[model samples]
Target: MTSWVKFTVSIPDTHQDALVAQLSTAGFGGFVQEDDYIDCYVEKKKWTSGVQTRSREVLQRFAKEYPKLELRTETTDVEDRNWNAEWERSAGIVDATKKIVIKPSWKSLRRRDKGKIVLHIDPKMSFGTGHHETTRVCLRLMEYYVRRGDHVADFGTGTGVLAIAAAKLGASRVIAVDTDSWSFENASENVLRNKAGDRITVHKGSIVALGKRPFDLVVANIDLPTITKFLGRLLTLTRKGGVLILSGLLMTDLVPVLRLINRRSIIPLLLADEGEWIGFALQRT
Candidate 1:
């Protein structure tokens, strides 16, 4: 259980993407609940007076530019840093038709179904230790696209979970890429744990640095704007007739993202949901 500082802001819906991106880059995680408002969660050490000062400076800048926005700050008690809480809280068991099992590094494999494929992940803060709705959706989608001997790419590869899933699901080659150094480092350890070094190559960079390798499958479990920004490039990275799995979207947020994709004429073959989150599987024509 780790402590967190919650900063709330009310801004125009149009500015939400930029604000979230800014906050994320500033080391705060954004949780948006509305078009005009979002909550930013920052760790205690990162929430010093300097952070508050910077927040005010940023708010002032935004207000000067976008006068209708509002800024608010509040402090709340948070559980100690357990890092593995999600796994413990969720019990770390994911069930699906393909009999795939995602286990946390701390727990032993239990109650597994026959013929199940298991992938173990160490609990970490970056993402995709398999506890979030977005990761769940991506994992299921990966089961569909990844076939034996197919090359795969897990863009925004947090904790390397999706990349590991692709490898376990029978993809012969996997290229996992992430802009976050922590995530990339975590992915390296996971690649070794899965004994997939021969099949999975984890790299630190965005799709841009991964170059133009066309893959049989590409999975991106990042937010809507990032997805939209890279959708065309993602399609280009995916071979014709390959599959692309995308998640990390709210149900209400999917329309704009879909509209953007449709603008490029990339029709999705599947749309899925787990809880309030939504995901799509697109086939590159």
Candidate 2:
């Protein structure tokens, strides 16, 4: 039998996105978000002492940053059993847009969904199952901005859902980059599962790997801090007058992120919100 470590973090709703971002960067996977907290799980064999220390550090930092929230965390050891069934039970069909329906490989599509675009995704250790607000908003923005034959770059391409969507939406080519090797591998599997192997390229690296290359459209569904950290690189990788879709921000994070956008001289064309999460579409001048 296998064992897993589970970290349950309690935080104010406003700080959920930020905490998720921190936990993701710390190498935690398999997340379930609740109204007042988040549960993150990792295999015991993979959860090293360093990872545990890092997780504590993240909690400490967030607690200090949001003192009023009184953020807290608890840990437990879980005996692994039938994770696939659990994931299947938790993940249903996600209607990202009128034209886009995200369904797990295990789920059968209805007859009415025949003509609509379907993305078959098997959620593994990576993110972006199209169930999260950030991913849904990003897909909607992709539907609105992607043009036929356009080249796209999907930063932090967790599960490669956005990259696959860009390809299904008529993008000629897509470059999907993620820093996590697991996400890179998972996204690769999803791209092949979606039959986008010829159109989408998966790279295991951060935005720095993009270099000076520019794309017609760039979509990043990552947290605010990571977004801000790579803003300059993202701007440089987007062609002049190209579209940039950014998500994974809480409503409270908007003002500061918008200020940064203004400083870059990019003007946002649209602002979209779902629940507490927000996304933006900007045009590079």
Candidate 3:
């Protein structure tokens, strides 16, 4: 039987998101943060020696970035089981948009959800549920930008929620891309769960691999660094006058990201702010 490794990461400082981003990049998912520690889960097979080395390297680098940051990780072996079902029991339905709802696979909708579009998401080993501010903001942005017959690209499509939402919202073709193996697999399954497999194709790499296809809309709900890294190319991938949505940024990221967008001659048409996270919508025309 396959097992799971739970890393109870303890941090001495409040710069937890930095570690969360690093862990996500390191292919760890299903993060549960608490007052003093964060729990990160990974499949036993993928918890290779190389992954451990890379994780240490990230911590060493993070020490330099945040002088007060001190990280301690303790690993626990977990038996393979239906973790998603456990999560579903506690996962409440969220009205991601007025017309769009996000619910777990086993949950039944109430009368209030009538006429709403429900996305049956199962994040077995990925980091996207509609509960986070970033995810909700990105979904809201899609509500405004995703048009009927639009070709959309969702970069870092964890659990494929945004791509599925785009497909449900009327995008003719939706391409969901993720670099993490778990995310790719989880998103692919969610795509099938939502019955959006016909319209959404899950790609297992960066957006660059998809070539120069003109997408009517491109959404990237990843961290600030990742967003900045691909902002230029993402802009180019969208057709002229098409929409681009960027999220997963802390409030501190506003200035630099806005400056980067300004340099590219792209003007943000809308700003979606939820808590400390903010998302922007830009039209390439």
Candidate 4:
């Protein structure tokens, strides 16, 4: 039998969702946030307990780092396994950058002059729904960077949205990549849905799995620290003087991340920001 633990935290209402998202990425499931309080359940293994401790530590760290924010933590049961099933009933539409509409399988695409692009996305258990800040920033960057008939490479392609968007923008060929099997499967399905199955090729593996072929443009919406760590490899993947659109960063994280890339001779040509998210357009020098 698997054991589990629950944490109930008193987080500010405004910051509850972000806190939940961070915890979700940390592997603690069962999120409930209401009236300045957040709750979560964690699997009760040694590693999970360590994560719980570390999560509390991070809450304390964040409190010290951002003094205005407040969060409280308590531990709770994995009573209902069927909780995730409720998600299917709540499947709905998501709007992306520039009013782009992403509809779930339950919804139908309607033609409208709302100046919004429509995408058919039945993500199932996959991540990239274009609802996250990082994905949204990347979409905006893709719109700005992709050129008609350009060859594009989308690293960490969550739902193949970036690659499909590139194809929609007239990229002759698109290579979509992700390490997770679930994402790879969903991306392949999503590409077919958008009638981009022919133009975009879905590859399952890390950025390394993408062979030595250089691309006219490479866009990675992974977080700042990851970007910094992989900057060299990313540079090697781009053609001489190709554009790199990097997002999934907070304003505070952008500078140091950019500095690391700058050392590698990558230069930022544009900086775009929305909400607390920031993205950059960099060109190889």
In model 1, what is the error at residue 144, expressed in angstroms?
Answer: 1.6
User: Per-residue CA lDDT of candidate 3, range 1-285, in tens?
Assistant: 878889888974366654675677766757766777888887888899987887777788777766765677799999877776667665778888788888886778989999998999877767678877788888888888888999999898988999899999999898888888788999998998988888999989988755699799989888777877887799889889999899887677799888888888686899999776799999897
What is the TM-score of candidate 3? 0.86
- Return the TM-score for each candidate structure: 0.74, 0.88, 0.86, 0.80
lDDT of 2 by residue, 1-285 (tens): 989999899875666766776687677868777789888998898899888888888788777767778766788999987767878877989888888999998889988788999999888878888877888989888888999999999999999999999999999999999988878988999999999999999999988765568999999998887888889889889999999999988787888997998799698899888887899999999
Clashing pairs in 3: none
Model 3 C-alpha lDDT versus the unseen true structure: 0.82
Worst 10 residues of 3 by lDDT: 12-21
Candidate 4: what lDDT? 0.73
> Mind giving the per-residue lDDT tens digits that candidate 1 earns over 1-285?
557776778666666644553455455532433657766667777787877776776567556656666666555646455545533554466553356677766667675455688777774546665556677778777777688899998898878988888888888989999887768888899889889999989889989766787999889888776887888899899899999888887676777976877776566888989766788998888
Clashing pairs in 2: none
Model 3: residues >4 Å from true position, as ranges?
Answer: 11-22, 34-36, 48-72
lDDT of 2: 0.87
Global lDDT of model 1: 0.74
What's the best-to-worst order under TM-score?
A: 2, 3, 4, 1
User: Highest TM-score, which number?
Assistant: 2
- Comparing 1 and 3 on TM-score, the stronger one: 3
